[model samples]
Target: MTGGIQAQIERVRAELTSRPEGLQRHVGRVLTEALDLARAWDVDPDRVELATWGHDLFRAASPAELVTMARAAGVAVEAPDLAEPVLLHGPVAAAVLEARFAVSDDEVLAAVRDHTLGLSEMPMLAKVILLADKVEARKRQRAPVMKQIRRLARRDLDLALLCWADWKWVEERTHGWQSHAQHWHARAEWVRQHHGEVALPPRVPETADN
Candidate 1:
């Protein structure tokens, strides 16, 4: 890693200290998982660490605050983002990391920006950060299936992400919650890619064996 990148990492890590203690602990846990996955996937640990720390910088902010920050950061607040301003946290943090911290790595910025609602096309480092954020110790405790996803990520990051999206789909349906268009679109692409098909018909009645 270049000295400039190392300094950027340090600055972001220090910024994390001002966040809530719970959020800080969560970031630490994510760092542990991210670094481990980075080594396994041959991603740069420093970059992963930077993304992990910066991903949730505004997580504790209220929805109104997040909307304000997103607007100030020049992030487009779409209808979904207006409905659920918390979703703007990642984009806001990414903007701050770039404009404030001078972190110029596009991949790192994408990882932090898209960690909440993953994009269809992500670099390996983004995958590591996203998976690590989802499978951290507390998250695993909350959802036992995260343990399985974490294991699957070691072998197949793409498959693990597909599975996670599937689980989230079911979860949202069960709770009668609307799916964000961005995530729904990304999940659709992941499904098509996983099946190695294009523009496949919807599985109206899903079964164990399709």
Candidate 2:
């Protein structure tokens, strides 16, 4: 490689390393695979890995904190709705990446933006980012308590989202905290409709299911 390309690569790596959000160890590893997939599939490898890392920038921040930050940054999200928390990092993260790191890759930022929603006909990079977030360390403990999640994750993603729906239901009910339970329920239903074969949660009550 030429010195100019090597210099550019080092600059990008430095940006990745200096990120204060502190990427999880396995997230870093999965990005290696994400980059490999991006290469195999003819996508830009750097942008793919960058998008994967950029997806979780503000995850450690509370929803209120994100709303406050958003307000400060002029995004104008009102009252901290379920959508706000679900997409806390997405828009702002992309904007930050663009401003600070000059990440102009359309597809990379696109994947980062839609990482939470699992939008229609997800491409490989988007799926990779979502799965990376799913199997991440913060979610590891939530796994065993969720038998249906285990089954669904292993069997079918549509059902997996259903299990995730019920899991969030029980979790929110127990903790009595605000969650994106409704939005996730809707997303699960959407996936089930188009993707097919996902059953409603076995033990989830109808009230929570909705």
Candidate 3:
């Protein structure tokens, strides 16, 4: 597994000087980091690629269709559990791995399923995927998200998830955001499921004198 990963890295690096060089490198780094996280968490090394491979699939997705597309893939998605971190690709990948590749490897599915928000009962690989997405350099907007990721890296998953919920709130409030609040509502459900608070952080103060 390690050898295969190393080979993949080499291939990615070799293409770093090609078209969209920066993007290629960024993808390479994210892939490497995700694999590293998986290994550190004692995930099956062979299954680490699932996280590294598709961590950024949604990068180009229309934010509005992100969860919809994931849900459209066909799996028994629970109402609240159907949101967040699961929409993060944990279940989609799990289903893909099961139905397509017939891998039936628990660790791989676990890594994919929990890559986004987080699971209440996080498996090793799941945590790795979460951290990998949160810390990847391509996600370099150091405002709210970076702040929370750095703070939550060494802390509790539930706490980190709360911070992410705050980040989601900010996005919803951002100008020209074309997405809906389904994920927010969905996240609220997850927060309730996990016994956490469901409130978004206080809105960025509007100019009082405006």
Measured with C-alpha atoms, the lDDT of residue 93 in candidate 2 is 66
Residues 1-210, candidate 3: write the lDDT tens digits: 233544543443343345354555665666666666554445565556645554443444343454665567775555444443335345554555455445455665666665655554656666666666666765756554665564565555555555666675677678644332444554676578556343655457689774
Cα RMSD for predicted model 3? 11.6
Output the lDDT of residue 179, model 1: 90
**What would you estimate as the lDDT of candidate 1?**
0.92
Task: For candidate 2, write residues 1-210 as lDDT tens digits.
Answer: 234433434555565565554565545755755565455556667556677777766656678777776666555464544355546666666666656556666666666766665554555566556544565544556575444443344444445554555566677679986545435556656556744534544545569547
lDDT of 1 by residue, 52-166 (tens): 9899999999999999999899999999898889899999999999999998899999999999889888899999999999999999999999999999999989999999999
Best candidate (score: TM-score): 1
Report how far off residue 156 is in candidate 2 (Å): 5.0
How displaced is residue 108 in candidate 2, in Å?
2.6
The better candidate by lDDT, 1 or 2, is 1
lDDT of each: 0.92, 0.58, 0.55
For residue 30, model 2's alpha carbon misses the true position, in angstroms, by 4.6
Error of 3 at 119 (Å): 5.6
Candidate 1: residue pairs that collide: none
Better of 2 and 3 by TM-score: 2
